[model samples]
Target: MHWLRGMWAAARSGVRLQPHHLCAPRLVLRATAGLALAGFAGYWLFGLAAGVLAMFGGFMTGITTFQRSWRPDPVVPLVCALTMGATTFVGYLTSGSLPLFLTAAAVWTFLGGLCWSLGANSGPIALNNIVILLITVTLPNSFDHALGQAAFLTAGSLIQVVLVMFPPNERWQWHRTVLASALTAEADYARGLKDNNTVHFTPDSFLQAREADTLSPWQAAHQPAGLRGVRGPAEEIRPILASLADPAATGPDTDLSRRQARELLDTAATVLDAVAHAVRQGARVALPPDTAAALAHPQAATVPADPAPRAATHLRTLLHDLIEAANSPRPGRESTDPVRPPIPEQLRQAVRTLRGELRHDSPVLRHSLRSTVVVVAGYLIGHNLPLGHGYWVAMVAVLIMRPDFAQTYGRVASRFTGNLIGVTLASLTLALAHPNELVTGLLIIGCGGLVFLFMETGYAAVQAAGSTYCILGLGLAGESWSDAMPARFALTLLGGLLAMAAYALYPAWETSLLRERLAEWIEANLHYAAAVIHQYAEPAERTALRTRDAVVAARTARLAWEQALVRAADEPVRHRGLPPATAAAAGQAIKEAARITMLLEGNLPQSGTAPVPASSPLATALRQSAREAAESVRNNRAPTWEPVRQALADWNTPNPQEKALHHAGTLLSNALDDITTALDATALDTTAPDMQGTR
Candidate 1:
């Protein structure tokens, strides 16, 4: 019954999807144009072979890598065609023998997968060629054939570049789209707080926020970059929004103080709605005088007064920051972007990353090996079977298989089932009548549009549209319609089974890395807490930087741990290290520790008259706790409570700052102790291995 419920839930999840937005048309149209032109022209000008290369090399490459990266240069589609062309040529050269192909694929894929640490687009750079290689292995080998393949590959991508150079007709562009989404989300989030409901922000929201800040307008790379007006406000309100959207899902629920907090949240929501609309309508937002006057009063500014953070104060900061960003950004703040790493430095970093991972029991290395084995198996079996288009078996395996077992397993049902629905739809369209240039062109466009539209929706819809396009594309390239569907169906099923089998037999679990992540998280939060404590010793102008660094580091470690936990749950292997409950408790410990650090940092003066010392006793206790926490997490030892009483003897409660520090310290100390208790019960091998840089 439990297994049935899980399956049913997975099926339901496949249907619910995120909606597509219009502000960022991006390079989709251009890529689609390139695809259509190449697919149409190649078949007529050259042959089916030329068409096949164009389809894979041109359109697929352009569209897959169309999204902009962090560096704001004129975003040219650089990776796809190059990767596709190389894979195609390589596959052709190695196809002379199955053994040769397998050896080449294993090595090539390993190197490519190593680049994944580089960035988001790097993953495609890793997998795209392998995907094309799967098809390439079936083609006959010859030098002239490889050259011709290379020439058409170049032509396909060049066409996309040319079309992308053309002007667009949209107003509120990418920045507007991102800003609107963020503002809308925050507005909704504020309302959720006011109504006492759970509010969660998905990862998509983060991507949109990042783009609004980083992306440049098309071709006009020198035209001052993305939404300069909202940059300060975007940075300011992002964390507050995160707090509101925290998955912990506490809602100031019905206490007297919370009732007071709700009224302020409602006002904040109204302000957010106005700001949201102003940004949407391309007008500046105004700071509401009523709220501003309330905050301006010293009495209201020092909120909660109960040691715990005041949501009202947080809301005020959020609203004021939004107003300043919308109406009065500091001079020169909008004039520049943060210094990004130079190309040389970035390359150096990538090389260093690759070198570092080479020695470890890295998942990417293992995943690459798994992917290679499965692809080779599929490739060999398909050839042996009496099936046409045997390459799809390998291609599908490459597409579906991932580094982690659970993720790979989850995709099996979705991909196989999605392929069935998608191919059936396309097959039915063709069965109605043979599609000429016009019919085929419309079908391709519709399918491409849906694929991008539903890309984030989930795997099933994406596969459906993706498979439909592939089948239609193959048909246009001269494959008999009768052969295409059966091949796709049979090959996809075989591929799915192969992927599931590969994972089940010798599945890799992310749990092995959990301790490292936990250690990292503890270290990051400790750094953050120490920075906040040090502020009490001597208030510094640059304290915020330390806090910001801490936030970033903690967020990184937390994300890795969360991903590991999810993967661990689905992973067949368990009892390797911290058991499930202990691991979860450890996660909660770190989360709360991070929150306390954030609160401490928030309470620190940006720059001001030194108040009574907030350090000592409580501050000293927290600093000590942080050190102990990091050491405990790294060494797998239960942290001993070593509370120093010297500072407490000198402490005075009349100082509000000291009181607040005391409160935050108490929380951090409790979290550290919780982590100690959680790990204390573990009975793993105590002899720690020689690991890489512990810090």
Candidate 2:
């Protein structure tokens, strides 16, 4: 009954989309188009074997290069194709006996599924090989056949290698674009703060910005030889970014000088825009003189009352680092040497990653077990039922199952819908038109092109195009899958059902995990905020890398909460968590306070300037708020932060630096208050029973 509702809810809704996500995945269209063109040409020239080679090459080309920058010889593509070819030989050699065939297929599915823990894009290769094993078994069992298949695959690989040597302008765009994007998001958040009327810092924009930033470092590493050392993550100069990102990202706008702070934030945005532009063009970053002046003059010692552009001033040093990196060239950083670690280390890491997930409470381990069951169940049903096109059952199963309920259920609905439409059309086509080499070739080309283009835009569309291409491509090999169209569609639906049902085999929902996830998020933010507060109170000589890691960790925990919450939304009445919006406000506020602390890190004691005494109001208030926030966050209770609040209100000593420090304390107090209020609202709401006292 629960599973039925999950399917209905998933099928009724459309896939949730993100903003500006169509940047890189569209490049995949070219590879698919190449597959359609080259695969059929090979079919026409050499035979069915050559066509399969060309088609598989193109398919793997898109999959292998999924996350990498534009470069020749992407590691995963080559590994996948070779694995496919090798496994093809082994599976074919065992095809004569039922026992041997079952053994080979089991090994293929299990071993391939295991590759998932290796890294992103690794699991698909594993699953692809299992499909290849199924596809190969349908052919004659002979070594001579395997050799013919292997030879054509090499030719197809050569074509893909040549094609990737030159790619579109957007190939490495996300890497550099995200560097600028993170800054731009920061700029927007800062500007929001400058308006002085906004309460929330807008968590989604900042979260998206941070996620983008996280992907930049690795992408930049693979951008061919010349574009190598482009400075890692926005954090390289995070101290400056922290301040610039800090004041703008957090605090009480009413507490500070409105006009001056707005100018400071607007100026910082302008500076970042220029930096973003330079990053895109691979040119040196240059800040405008007015912005430079902001950084150079933190304050006039004579007039202690004027607030300085502290973040912008600190940001000047960050600009210099980016400029220096942009102008310099580092050679061969992404080595041509094979990218895999030594076999021993690779095995060790893969085992460690998998073992860690196999705990009694591990979601990933449970998901993996569920996947294994789905694969085995689909195979057993197909084999026993005498379905001629049985591979389609497991093929859809592999494609649809996901690590979580929302995604798996969503893919089940989408894949089943797509396959239904596609297989029906292909059936009509095969029934109406003559089955010849030329017609098959044309269908493959058309469907392949559509598959890649729609991949990121619409899941159902991709499935429709992909299923057509697969059916038509296999028809060229005399598989006659389209002849069994009704059966194939039924099996595809079965695959999807099994995928959906698999999640129930090991139930783990956000409702069950909410307490731990929230606890982890709070703990991470607590450490991050503490590091930031202390830095502001006592300016650091150097950036603390540990503090930066803590920020990253907090962001990670926050993301986990977001993803789990999404899954919880699809769950039953008894299995859901507190709403994301409330949690997000508290979470984002914590990040804002931390970011301000980071920005203030570069406020080193200037040579002639004397440090403020430890007993000063701002200093003492910061210490008190930091202490109170720790307890409040730990217990999910409203803090009696009257000391910090009083300290902020009474610190009428006209000093710009002191005012900024006071604002940081206010941000801390408000953030704690927000956390407490959110928890209270959740506890008071009787509609959801997911959390325990909302703690």
Candidate 3:
């Protein structure tokens, strides 16, 4: 019990490394030395049988199978292991030949690929094990030799995991902080996009915001059960984005003001991104120049650095008041003025018609499927080549080929460049000293530690190259470390070419499905906004509605952006015209809508209660005008601001609420005009004959 407690304390202590305090070089050296010693000791004491198994097992565990945000059920790992083990066992029983073993291994690889597409966490690792088992069983080798290798590998994996669990609790904290910072930066970026008014109605900005939003939710979900806390910061941020996306709030006339707001948001977003990056690299967050300026600005300085804290306090107070209100149980009183009947059938039909056209599916999915198929085919072909070590090349291809060619191509170029540098260094190391089993083990540990420390940085390819060198140095398949470089480089190049070819071809059909889907999503969101605004009778209801709207808008925007990429993949010719829109615009619209809805909800009198009125005629006129504007928008009619203008003309109006309502009405009318114009423009451009097939 004491030993267990001690181990727990050590683990906890190790988790506390500050982002900037991690000593990368020392950590790498220590990890390398530890793993090397463990590998050798395991081989000597337990023999190679267990060691080899453990090493392969660890390697399998290290391979990433799913996207970062995916979270599978806890039982998934068990299921994956069972499936992998059972298939291997069956293969061994049915056919005891090398060729048969290779075939089974290939099948296992395909299954792993499928699992990846289906979003499985351990799929790649499971596939690696299957390959290892096949190789061990089929190779003409002594039983003792195979057993020894397996034992050593297993020991290596165990040691690697142990080495990773070291003292430095600050490191973990930094890592978490980094993630949070990235999300924050993304939010700010979205804000900036809206402020710029660069295609305010497009999906580009929304997608980026969605990505950030997704990360936030995932982090919340992944928090350990007992330690889980409320996500108040994200909740507050949600309204800001919602407000941005609300077409009934943000107007073209206020573009300059919106831009200023965006600048502030972008500053905050960059701060967050920097923080996340710093944590991952074991560094501190460094604010950019513009970010510094915004923070220092006199007017913006009043905005809380931590909006979540203020929101949480406010929410708590509001809830308490609500609870008291509920407890007191005020008696219901009849209203002097009767409620209006339901809207006219003609108006309802018109609203339905407008919504139906907007709700049509986008053409993005078809294009995505085509591109995905091409990439997958290329990967299979590259891996299945007659060359001895072509699979590594195939792996590289998988990492580099993205739907967005520019980004994917850049990553591929960087990866290759980094790999070349890493391989050269590894070759020199091998030449300097014959990489014995001990050296090989040390290298693996060293690579693992580097990966662990710098996984957050944009240098994953370099880390992969280091890991590759260590793996090859182990003298597997009678291959010498010194001679492997030339073949490895050639194979990697071939894989890249194949991937490029696949990207260039594969889509035989052209359609605007992606665009249609995006438009539909936007239309659906608009309808949702209308419903929420119309039903804004209570504060609690408004808050819930706002949150839902923000989330949905973010998600839809992300989908639209992703679809656009997919569309570009299928129709490269159209890529130049359909530039990615900033996610901030959509976020801003959503945020604005949320804010207004909240205001309306807050202003609503309690059940059977009437709002206090001003004695002045100007106040009465302003209130009436606001109500008319709201009604007009709800009825899908063009809102006229003549009444609002007349009300505003009276400068000495004494009623604050009336003045507020008049201003709100004016803003709403402007927003409606901007939205209508944007929609018309989008419809015209998208429906053009040449652009019809792009989406």
Q: On residues 513-621, what C-alpha lDDT tens digit does candidate 3 reach at each position?
A: 3333333344444343333333322325454454356445645644554555453443344322222342233334433433444333323333343333321333344
- Model 3 poorest 10 in a row by lDDT: 331-340
Q: Taking the candidates one at a time, how many backbone clashes does each contain? A: 1, 3, 78
Best by lDDT: 1
Residue 53, candidate 1: how far off, in angstroms? Answer: 3.2
Best-to-worst order by TM-score is 1, 2, 3
lDDT on C-alpha atoms for all candidate structures: 0.62, 0.59, 0.42
Ranked candidates (lDDT, high to low) = 1, 2, 3
lDDT of 2 by residue, 233-314 (tens): 2344444433432334333333344455556556656666666677677676677888767656655211112223444444
Provide C-alpha RMSD values for all models, in order.
Answer: 5.9, 6.5, 14.8
lDDT of model 1 at position 587: 69
Residue 620: error of model 2 in Å? 16
Candidate 1, after superposition: displacement of residue 408 in Å? 1.3
Question: Clash pairs of candidate 2?
Answer: 242-599, 243-599, 295-313
Look at candidate 2 and tell me the lDDT of residue 584: 67
Query: Which candidate's TM-score is highest?
Result: 1
Q: Native-vs-model 2 lDDT?
A: 0.59
TM-score (C-alpha, index-matched) for candidate 2 = 0.77
